[model samples]
Target: MTGDAAAVAAERVAGVAGELAARVTAYDALRDHRAVFAYTYFRLTSDLAAGLRTNNPPFRAPEWVADLSVSLAAAYFAAMDAIDTWLGPVPDARPGGEVLSADLPETVPEPWRDVYAASTVRHSYVLEEVLFSMMAHMSYDLPLALRALAARGDVHHRIADFHRMNSLLASSVDVVQAEIATRYCRRLRSLDRLFVRDDELFTSYGIRVARGLAWFNCDRLLDPDASAEALGSISRSTAAFIAEFRSPDDWRRRRAFQVLRALVPSRRQWPAPAAPVAVGSSPG
Candidate 1:
């Protein structure tokens, strides 16, 4: 995309972001993060559909990027709902009438805010946005959330809850992809088949990697001196990576073999249907 076209796309993306933020404030359903995620995805779905009809996507990238966003937004929405449904509500870190125990409004942890804010400015690739989002959410937001809420005594339960949410996201991969294919990628549906394998790696394996990063940061957040430094370091690293990480190849080979060889499943099979595991269950 040329400078002019990119600017136009960025403007559209910013509008989408702004519209979503405004909806969160206005709509009661979007008052919480999880529900807000659902609203964001719902609106994004509508915008993406409009873009598809007009042939003017905000990112000007492939439909896969939009599909990826759809899947991610769905996962986030589902995870939040699943765990929060079972555990009840978590306090908004943002300032309101409720007094927060922390000094700040539990804003998006360092690099997360940076990465997400710069989604339009940083890179052209849709996957890059995904990468930056993963780092921020897993490394910064999740840990801060743990620290800001989850009582010390219930830390284990919260961690389990996090895993449960992550698992819910992982399980919903197919459903999200199908929705994207139906709604966002109708024209590109046939070509999208070639990328089907890639989406699985991107979503399911991606969540596993994200969970690992979250665990890494969660441990740091549990410690006083390390939490801030660790988050800052992650922010710095993500900043550097986003600025420097690029190539003409569009990360194809990278995606083909995204996961490590050791982590590959042994003739894998999906788990059977089970109840939404309760997040507030007392750790045995």
Candidate 2:
């Protein structure tokens, strides 16, 4: 492709990736405290995997693995649906200001809009396969690791402090005008550390995003004469951040793209429909 055409493609990719990032990042931020946490979490991860897997190799994920992955994502979505039934919408349109609605390629703040935008692009599918779906599945899997700690009750009791936490978060945002003004840069840095991976998958993921941004970012800091150098720097920084935060745990080196590996049963086999009962359950 011509340099200009390639540049345009990169810009488009960046926009898509940015939207996906926004959704994923937003869900993660809200998942712990908001009523919408479950919904946002599943939706965002499902969408992310959908996008990432397209570039994934064949047989990297088998049928059973794929099915379970999709199911895990749906479970989170279902959990969100349940929350909506009992509680209510988590309020995507927070009261902070107009920062989220601002145009992209510019104006969009660092982490919030950027992450949500990434989630959106990841979910946009062309056919039967969805890259984000896998991500959504993986996202659900992350919390599932803690399910043993939460099995005492259903969603609400499991996430008992949600409302309080969300309330605190909401109040914090209102103190400022725009999201940028309100955003805790410390929080962003902290979370980036939490999810970033230096391994192959994460490295590739970061590179892809950086490449997308390089193609799209028209920031004055990236003049054509220095664009290559700038892109290299950005890519390295992203990779470094991602590597610093991630673990060998999420990389899936154990199973080689086996989706089931991400799915940890509460206390049984893969895709266990029901939770295992304790050896000493009372007689009916």
Candidate 3:
């Protein structure tokens, strides 16, 4: 039984997501950043899909996976919208000669490209996936985005906005983990301790550290020497790091990463969450 077939099935891919992009791209003053914003729309959509809600946070999978994924989607969504506000549609509104500026296709840019490439690594722990994804976005993609636009009108504001959106993203982490992780711990009692450690590091400090790197990269973008070479190096190196980085083999401390990773849920057994139900309408 159906009325309009299209309406019956939600299109979550880029639904309503492009409003920010549309607003940003419409500013004639922001012509250069058009593609960057467009690609960002695609990513927000993708992450929305990744973290789509499910009844069971954990059968076998780690709970934080979906929460982190959803938080990132929301962060990027807010970040893009904030950029629109920051740049100001009125050409004469801000510094830097009238204005400042701001996908998913195989043709998309880096950091994100690295994220997509790493998407195939299903074996990564949920926290690992979260960190790696953040690294690619903050450290690689963002600075590269500013680099492409070549606008430094309000550098301080740019940094502030970056952190503001970050705070927005971080605010959700506590709530998500508190709710989902409790249930996940019940399901796999043995792994609860490992998951707890992951949460502590991630929430207490790991995320902020990564954000610091991202802000630093934004600073680098302002450099004339930071061109394609800089972006390329960051992208390549970050991808490799995401693939391989782990806690160090310790001294006699006996708390080794291998021990924690061994306790990580087997994707084979628990399986990553399924593709989420489409929730909203797609952007044309």
Candidate 4:
């Protein structure tokens, strides 16, 4: 894509990010745990859009990164649409600004289904919800998004840009974590020190590991000789990882999560969902 085209794509991504931010604000107002991931994603996309607009963009191939970002975001929104279809609409949450689509997917991806399903259970930990959402998006959707870009004949040379996103993501972690704490769980900020591994799990080490695995999966998907069985195996492994994290069977991790759960406010303690707000309005 030309420079002009890249600028347009970046603007489009900004608009989508704006819409997502609006939704996240609404969800946060409702004390919905789903907001954990939505808010994080909104920040990442918003940052990417801003980076692309800068004179000295961090990425080597801004256009390709913009396209990949959009494709990956589409997967998340598709999952949200599916969740909305399954559980009815979130109270007072409506799409505003640049919306992706009015149509919902016929079937949600299994990994996403698992994430959303875990989200609905009242007992689920805030940290787990965040991690589960990230796992689903990064581990499952990212490779597919990369594969789509490869199919378009643009991704082969953009691997460096893809890797560059890790730094951008790392920069956003502190900001995202702070926002989540202020909006959802006030205890989250300090809890990380209490549970150091949990902190690294979502904010740093785990993300790099997941992204590395995603690129590997993308390479596999791009292989001309790759088989359906191989793809299925990848999907199963991703799903299994999500499941294991969702409810850690190991005594130590489970016990740690249990302690973490007690440290944060329970779902019932949250204020009830507020009345619908006007589109484009900021959360109070």
Candidate 5:
């Protein structure tokens, strides 16, 4: 990686403040929002920050949640700086002093356009799949987390949006990831006879997991006891599969199986039945 890449990775910002504000002002006004809402919000921001610092391209978020948060922040500042630099030349709108629209057209617009485009990347793609994966990841023991909270009873509007949008966003990312993984494997193995060893090769994969974790902040996944149970089962099954691979005898086989297993949730964590509709359903 380049020095610039390292610099970018080292960069940090306070997104937690924003998340907290949203929870207090916009999310469910009742239902002990602190217990369920704040934890998920903070967890998401924390995970997002970690993911960005450790991502490939030195800090590219493989999935859209982190991509949206980090890129939007970067894009916002970059655009502002560009605008400030452009404005620096202009002293005043004094008569005989011509304000140049030409300069604004040239330098200012391009950066802003780029920034705006970067900001909305998540809204335009599959995020649900990421949410689904995050729900199943073993790190949080999400099943226990949800069960501890028990049934939330009624769905709050903010929670509803979080579930539906996150799931859809993750779904988009999954499609892209599957396609990218296929190409990465094919080219690295047989298609181009290319050497596979590279430092950044695994960066994308890590970012994917990080963003996946952020997506899990969707409140619906965390509140529903059944969904949590489902996730718990999948996590255990995945852990079991990975354990088998840890033995020296199964190294190569396990590695290959890992790739195949990547798409499927751990069977142990996966619920045998569909989760109850506490909120509404996603569009078919």
Candidate 6:
């Protein structure tokens, strides 16, 4: 892509990120736990937009990275919209009628369904919600975004830019964590001090590993010989990964409990879900 094209794409990314930031602020006002991941994502997207606008962008192919970022963001928003629709009251139903099951629509990706369900559960911690959102986005949405980009043109040359995204993601962690601490979970600040260096290290490492797997899966997706089967396998693996995170026997859950125990007095408190805003109601 030409420099001008890259600039256009970067602007689009910035626009999307700005819209997401607005949504995060609104979610925060509602004391919605979804803001945990939404805020983190907004920071990451904001950073990417900034990087793309830099005179000497870190990405070798700025346009490709910008496009992929926008695509991924679109996927996230689509899934969230689907969740809202799925969870909303059934249209024109009689009073006290049986509502639809909690299952998301078939159009909603499986991994995201799990994340939405987990986020709504009472007493779930911030870190678990964050991790589940990350897993769903990275494991399920990313490969599909990559494949879409690949279908348009060769993405082999853009591999470096894809890997470079990890650094961009890492740089935003401290700021994201601090903001989440201030806005959503006060205990996150205390938890950060308890783990300190290990907290960031583990978070960054897990992101790198997940993104690396995403790229590997992208390769599998692009393979002409197995693309059909690869798609099914990717979906299955993503579902299983999320299920493991939801499992009681999972080490991550056990560790989260230990962290919860260590910070006994500072248990995470979630606010009640806000009443739905009336249509045409302007945000205060």
* lDDT of all predictions: 0.42, 0.29, 0.42, 0.66, 0.33, 0.68
Best TM-score among the predictions, by candidate number: 4
TM-score of 3: 0.45
lDDT (10s digit) by residue, model 6, range 202-282: 266777888888888889988889778877876666456545554447577668756654555434554345633222111
TM-score, every prediction: 0.43, 0.23, 0.45, 0.78, 0.23, 0.77
lDDT string, candidate 3, 35-120, tens digits: 33233334344333222322111112112222223334454555444544544567566334221111223334445545434433
Ranking, TM-score, top scorer first: 4, 6, 3, 1, 2, 5
lDDT per residue for candidate 4 within 75-149, as digits (tens), equals 888877776675566565543222222222447787776666566554565666677778778878988888888
Instruction: Give me the candidate number with maximum lDDT.
Output: 6
Collision pairs in model 1: none
Clash counts for the predictions, in order? 0, 40, 2, 0, 26, 0
Candidate 4 lDDT = 0.66
Model 2: residues >4 Å from true position, as ranges? 1-55, 89-187, 190-284
* C-alpha positional error of residue 90 in candidate 3 after TM-score superposition, expressed in Å: 47
Give me the displacement of residue 262 in model 6, in angstroms.
Answer: 15
RMSD to the true structure for each prediction, in A, is 19.9, 24.2, 16.9, 6.4, 22.7, 6.3
Give residue 13's lDDT in candidate 5 (0 to 100).
Answer: 25
Candidate 3 contains a number of clashing pairs equal to 2
Model 5 alpha-carbon miss at residue 236, Å: 3.1
Q: Return the clash pairs for model 3, or none.
A: 15-281, 39-103
Candidate 6: residue 51 lDDT (0-100)? 70
